[model samples]
Target: MNYPLIVFRGLNLLVVLLCASLALGAGKPLTDFSLEELMAMEVTTQAKTPQRLSQTPAAVFVITADDIRRSGAVTIPDVLRMVPGMHVAHIDGNKWAVSARGFNGRFANKLLVLIDGRSVYTPTFSGVYWDIQDTLMEDIERIEVIRGPGGSLWGANAVNGIVNIITKSARDTQGGLATARAGNLERGSGALRYGGKTGDNFYWRGFVKYFDRTRHHGLPGETAEGDWDSLRGGFRSDWYPAAGEQFTLQGEAHQTRAGALRTEPLFTAPFARLNDEPTETDGGFLLARRSWETDDSTRYRLQAYVDHFQRRRNLLDEDERRTTLDLDFQHEFAPNALLDITWGLGYRVSRDAIDSGQVITYRPSKKTDHLLSAFAQAELPLVAERLTLYAGAKAEHFESVGLEVQPSLRLLWTPSTRHSLWLSASRAVRTPSRTEEDALIVLSVRPFDPPLPLTSAGNTNIATEKVTAFELGYRGLLNDRVSLDLATFFNFYDDLRNFEGVPAAFVLPPPLPPLDALFTTRNSETKARSHGLEAALSWQAHERLRLMGAYSYILLHVEPRLGEEDFDFSEEKTPRHQASLRAWLDLPHNLELNTWLRYVDALERGPVPSYLELDTKLAWAVRDNLSFALVGRNLLDSRHQEFPVESFLKNSVTEVRRQIFAEAIWKF
Candidate 1:
């Protein structure tokens, strides 16, 4: 393929379109807000409270609804690529490896994810199943991404970052919407949604969505087997029960059948071979929340949710069912004119039942775990509105890890309304997952005559992984038409996860071969330190054109404590440099054009070579509530690899291919 020529031609076409649009000046601009208005936007994920972006003492980025629609991203993971410090890579057609800063993998455990205040991080594997996390993209209000530790408020597993997906209120989406899309890679997809009002105070909405994705190219001539389809339906309702009180109820259910190619070792003659398998998953959740404000300027909220899921995987011969129940309460008050305080309490219980497989087994097939936590933060104004100080901590108790405490201190200095500077230091931890403490896995087997097997045994005495991070940031409006955000961080890690070699043992059966080597999962003497810089710039080039650019550089170093071996692969997993540029232009005849160009550095371990790609979208609005769009993704190349196959799962490596799709949306 003539990759360079294709990219050149694409860019030329984009330029030609821009020229025509400028000459005609016909379409409405996507964003009419000024840089100051953008800087003054309020975000909640940073502190669990509303704070202006320019004054918040954290590294935060928000993706608005307009950004989502213009990015031509079909999935949440693809939309996240715009964040400066975030690393998003596709493992296959149905799987992705996403992380922040460093330590990227199939199951990146350090980053925490939430959907409408409900956590989606699974306790079974300490990671998310990206294939099943879905919703109607049009209904998403915004995605708030915190690029630093949120442990002081959100609790464990939030060591690196937090991603919160917030949806729009039912009242904002009153009407009926229908959408359909088709393409070579996407296959087919459609959505139907309706919103109505029962009374003056009550609003409700319901929606159903379905999608089928085709498989991607495999390594060279091999056929990659990952293809998936999903169906989901959900509803949300909001009621203003009284003058000072409000209530919200929402629920969703989903079913998915995903295909994959797995390689596993057998106890018999042929050590390992390929296995074509399909994974079946079904899940649902219901959540309710209530909020009230008192005349004395005090606020209170209560929320609860129940979630359940079941999965069947043939490659591991495992069938699993899990359920979780969580409850939380929060209060906010200003004791005095100079000081404000926020506090919360939470409880969660999770239970899982697993049927063991030939390759993997859990000591206790059925187990239950509980977590209790409380957190409080106080904000003190030092120099009126110019300087402020914030301190907070969270204490959590669990059966396995006893008690864990995370604390943070932050200071923000606003020199002017247009610029602010901030610094923070925090501590966070990651608790052990069920698989790390109870499962025994057959990592691989040597093709010897006797068939020597290498196994990984779980250790019950594993400790929590911990990190202490320091960060400094600046957010400012460079001018009336431009804005800039910069952040730098240094992190130190301790008690990191590692595998230690154990003595080999023989099997009881006489004909069976002995275990060649064994390793146990544990918190070894491995330590690490990382530093990075991230910057983002936004320019409203004209009333009809907007441009955004981002760049990030990171360096991670790992070493053994004293004379111990590292025995970890954290250093080579993350890329060293990443950059992206995006442009949105309004054209004549109600036309819109958006383009994104991105580059990712290679991973040292897989030697996955660096690659650059482009995605473009062109849309035409026929009326106020009807539109059509043509989207092209990965136009620079036919296919390219983004990540290597996971070592533990041994899934087949696949490449991302060029895709073109057309979409039509109608609202009545």
Candidate 2:
């Protein structure tokens, strides 16, 4: 069954359009909210400018800081499973292979990631090395995930999706705190943080964290045990020198040690893998922005930022450095029905050195990319505040891809104060990976009955991946105490590259003999679509007790054309159904109780086995400025796997059993 998102999108659009067109002609007029209210929408453009996810035309979800704190989960990937259409694979204690829609693996290349506007994808593998991205979980302000192309606003590598992690401002976390964690699986973890106000407008904070974990001890056979350790430290500072201008500085340094296994075809020998791989990384970002509320009716922002980061992976035996400088300015003349204009340009210089025996180089290679882009979006209130439409397009020029244009159109309507509807369509493109365009790998030739063709290494010709997406959503305040949010989306992809086998024969002579097959990069000429529905509800049952739950249903489809018909690859690792429940109950005294339950369905087949994870926390105010917390995760001792999946060893890997920890927090 071809579950193309477009088919559903088309139907949704027609219905929305017809309803909107008719409502505008026959319904009562609408009320225009204040700019403050419009901006109340969460800013979730994922690396784009600050805009509410509801107002943005793209398909996006925001995992707020409150959500993170309430979940009582340990890692970022664990929180990611809550989002539909995204594939999250917790490969091991210290590693995660995550992507959107599909193409999920240890090094998921198709997804682009940003830490406070700085790109974190590895140039060596064309993806983010999730294991290396570490920071204090408490420091995260919010994480915005977009499940479709964001190429126009964020250049390339966003083929499948994008993830942006935004940290909390120094001013928001002002105090001194210490915490320690230990459990059955998570043997040891600790954190220390301090922050203070430098002046009326300046605030600074610093933190240090260390973590050690025991690997999954599966059902005998000595199949799944590896140890992991990591040490990290970071600091952040924010300054509001004046009323409307702000300066932000943040940096982090970390080192990690983890066990790894090697893969080879030989069956008679034992696996001799690296006992432990140690990696160290350091990075920082500086940003300055000034905003002026010009005359109450007009507002504008001018901003610039610089990012410097470096990383060293033992397996790669090399160090990579990236430095980026960017400048942007935008203005909005508003009142609800007004004009908004935005434009920006950025420059990035990435330099690296490869040590011997590493995949990046026995030698070293360096390349710097330049990018220039301008974008403009306009919103018009047609027929008073009853109907509104927005259209925007981004024109970007990359050093390699030349010029690319991404355009978006959207419409929003509010039939009544309680009901709202929106529809959007957009086009985006993902840039090529550095490895596909530059890396050199040796190919091993093997024979086959069908007789494959062979070709040597070094293919310089590659093109950027592209995607077109459509989305629709509705929001309603069912009652004074209840609210709901619902959305659906679909995306189409082109020029997905995969390795293919070539026939090895008498094609070459001497030192380079022609082999039966070689693995080279080729365009799959494939198309993929993801259609899913996300529904969430929040009910304020009482002044101190609130309940919330969310559910997502997604259907992913992939079709490969232009040869290799037998390779029917569906986007794996993403479940079709995910449901979560959260409840906060306040008992008689000053004590509070929080509970969370998440269910992730298996994708391998019918009546898929879903995993249930439960978390509970009890908080007691110890003093005016201090509190104690008791947290228990996987309370069920759920022997089931958190991310149990096929490993590179042709078997499956399971996560550790249960964990319970006690923590304390202090504010001054």
Candidate 3:
């Protein structure tokens, strides 16, 4: 890739577009809110309580609905690129590797994700299945992202960060909406939605969506085999039975079919072969929540959810089914003028059944796991509006892990309304996943003279990975038109997962040769530390033009315990530097143009070179209820590889290609 040439062209194009957009006549401002309103936005993910962005004592970022509309992003992962210090990469058309700070891969386990207060993080893999986590983009109200530990409030697995996707309520979406989209890459996609009110206090909404994406191009003349398609439908109902009280019930179901070219290892003559097979996934979840506020300003909430999913993969000959039930309750109240308290209790149970395959098997084919947790946090007004302190801790218990405690302390100094500084220290943990405890996987088979088969066996005694993090942050309205947020953090990790070599036992079967090499998972004395800095700036350059920029830098170090060897490539998995700039312009006659340019540093381990990319969107509002758009993505390069093939799956390497799409949205 010609980095200089690509960057120069990208800048030139940006300038040309900006000049053209400015030359046109200006209409009404496209933004409904001013920059001040944006700066004062409220976020709930950081502390699980609504607070102004400037007052949140954490590294937080919110992706507003308007931001998403102008981003030209068709997927949730793509929209996350705007967040500083976040890494989003595509392994194929249907798979994404998303992480915060570092340690990024197919199954990056350090981050926690939630959808409308429901936990979407899978205990089976300790990561999110990005492929099937989807919804109507237009229905999302906002995405609140906390770029640090949330374990003190959210419990276990909130090691590095948390992402909470909040959708608009049925009352807010009352009406009818339809959208259709098509492109060379997207192929075809559409959505239909309707909302109504049964009475003054009750509202309901339902929606259905479907999309199909064509396969990506491979290394030269080849075509990657990861075409994807999905159909999903869901409904939401909200009832305000009385003042200061509300009830919400929602559910969704989805069916997905995706293809992958995987390398399958065998014990026979042909040790390995490329297998192109389709994977089928079906899943659904039902969630209910009730919240009420008392006359004295006390608030209480109770929520429950049930989730079930099944996956079948022909390449691996694997079939798995899992179901989870969770219930939670929380209360918030201020006992005095100087103190406020929030606490919660939660319980979850998960059951899973797995069918063995040729390359993978589990010691226990069926199992159940239980989790019990309680957390509390106190907010103290040490110096009234100038200085405040927050302290919290959570205690969680699992049958295998016994008891675990996570704690956090934070201090916020506002000094003034426009500028605020904060500091935090927190401890978080990533519990062992089912795969690390019971599964046996055949890693590779080298058809040597004796057919050496390398296998990895799970250990039941593996310990949870732990991290202690310290963070300092500042948020300031540099001026009326510009706002800036800066954050830095240092993290120390202990008892990280590692692979230890085991003495191989020779096995000679009639149809296969002798097997020799073996390894086992362990929470070895492996330790690591990381430090990073992130900065974001937003400038309302003009009434019709808005610009945003972000940059991030990270460095990680890892070492093995004394007399022990470590093979984990924790430090080289993520890029050390990343930056992005975006511009949104509203032009004459209800026309809008938006562009995003970004650069990502190379990954030492993926051996993937650095790359620069650009995405642009142009839309025209034909009427108050209808609009059309043309979007171009990856315009800077024809195609580029964002990540390497995953080790476990050995999925085919697919490059992201330039794509152009057209969309139409109508509201009634």
lDDT of 1: 0.87
Q: Write the per-residue lDDT of candidate 2 for residues 1-668, one digit (tens) a residue.
A: 12245336433643453444444343221212222243245774632556654445455677777667666677878778667566675655566768776666665777888877667776656777676676788888888887766665666566667888888889988888777777777688989999999758889999999988887655435356446778888888888876656667676767666654332221112312322344555665666656666555566666666666666553343456666666666665655535554445555555555432312332225667666777766777664555778777778777766888887777888776567688877787766655556554332223444333333233455566677778788876777667677878787777666544553333332232243334454554666666778777767555455566778777876666644421223454557777776766555345666777666678562122556666788877777667777888766554555444443222225564676777766665
TM-score of each: 0.95, 0.81, 0.96
What digit string (tens of lDDT, one per residue) describes model 3 on residues 1-668?
A: 78888778867866775676567646568886777797689998877777899899999999999999999898999999999999998888888889998878878898899999999898877999888899999999999988989999999898989999999999999899999999999899999999999968999999999999987777555558779999999999999999989999999999999887888888777888877778899999999999999966599999999999998983365788999999999999998878989999999999999887767777788999999999999999899899999999999999878999999999999999999999999999989888888877777877887677777777889889999999999998989999999999999999888777454554533223446655555554688899999999988777788888999999988866643434333576789999999988898888998989999999876578888988999999999999999999999788898987666777777888899999999999
- The model with the greater lDDT, 2 or 3, is 3
lDDT of each: 0.87, 0.63, 0.87
The sequence of per-residue lDDT tens digits that candidate 1 reaches over residues 151-242 is 99999999999999999989898999999999999899999999999979999999999999999999886779779999999999989978
Better of 1 and 3 by TM-score: 3
| lDDT, model 2, position 316 | 40
Ranking by lDDT: 3, 1, 2
